[model samples]
Target: NYNVLEQVYDVTKFLEDHPGGDEVLLSATGKDATDDFEDVGHSSTARAMMDEFYVGDIDTATIPANVKYTPPKQPHYNQDKTPEFIIKLLQFLVPLIILAVAVGVRFYTKSPSA
Candidate 1:
């Protein structure tokens, strides 16, 4: 299980070296950052200080009804990374051949246990 206390202490020490901002780490406290808890050894409940300690002061956004973000211009340069069919076939074949060799070696090396 994740220990919130331990995490807080560790986070405090690491905060000084944090590049982006200390607020980012502070905000991650009560939130769930673990994607796979089943395999993880530690976890913690992140505090909802995102509103309280985040980088900038909280202010209401004022976007006009007709205002829209200007889209970036798409890159016109093209290297044409298309590959031939035979090249793709060889790439697929090489991995399968290696795997088959590995499995064959394991099977040959296996001996029944008493």
Candidate 2:
């Protein structure tokens, strides 16, 4: 009754053959084991052995009530907007440039000392 990447696998019979031990496989019964399987870093031969135990694809409609399916997030971007680096540069430089121009104007307009 274990699900791995949407595939149903009956590991109950293969429990004794599991290299990690029967307890490890038994612990993952009736649950998604994709993460656990990948984390264990099973060898290529071990991966090939999975086909022997695979029963069929999990029926999406029949999934248990507790299982929550999350849809992938959509990527968001403003294609028409200016690039972030350019916008940041303008934000930083525009004020400094205006301040410099104002100071220059003040210095040029000052009367000469006697």
Candidate 3:
């Protein structure tokens, strides 16, 4: 079983074509081969080849609790430390402040009669 999904594959047939050799596949027989398979960094073609050998999925209830897969949780952003609101406000206001100053300087530099 791999990632809580039972993979039915023809080890005998795959062994003949396996680039790593038959011994590697033999060692993983009747066991979860996910770690070994990932560590090798198999090519996309190798992953695609699995489709032909797939039989069907195993029920999640049948899988042992310890071996069940859970996706990694995403890290939460600390908004309090970064002050995102203030950063966004400054981003919007800074350009307007510069434009206002430029206009004021141009007006002041002009002659009263102009």
Top lDDT model: 2
Give TM per candidate.
0.27, 0.50, 0.47
Tens digit of per-residue lDDT, candidate 3, span 1-112: 4345566676687888889999999998877788999999999999999888777776555755686669999899777568887898899999999999999999999889
- Candidate 2 residue pairs in backbone clash: none
Tell me the tens digit of each residue's lDDT in model 2 across 1-114: 654347889988888888899999988888788899999999999999899998988765565579677998988866547598688888999999999999999999999999
**Model number with the top TM-score:** 2
Quick one: ranking by lDDT, best first? Answer: 2, 3, 1
Q: Sort every candidate by TM-score, greatest first.
A: 2, 3, 1
Give residue 68's error in model 1 in angstroms.
Answer: 38
Model 1 — which ten-residue stretch has the worst lDDT?
A: 1-10
Name the runs in model 1 displaced over 4 angstroms.
1-83
lDDT of each: 0.53, 0.86, 0.83
Compose the digit string of candidate 1's lDDT tens values, residues 1-97.
Answer: 3223212123565577655467765776654433322343333433343223333322223323376779999977544454666687779999999
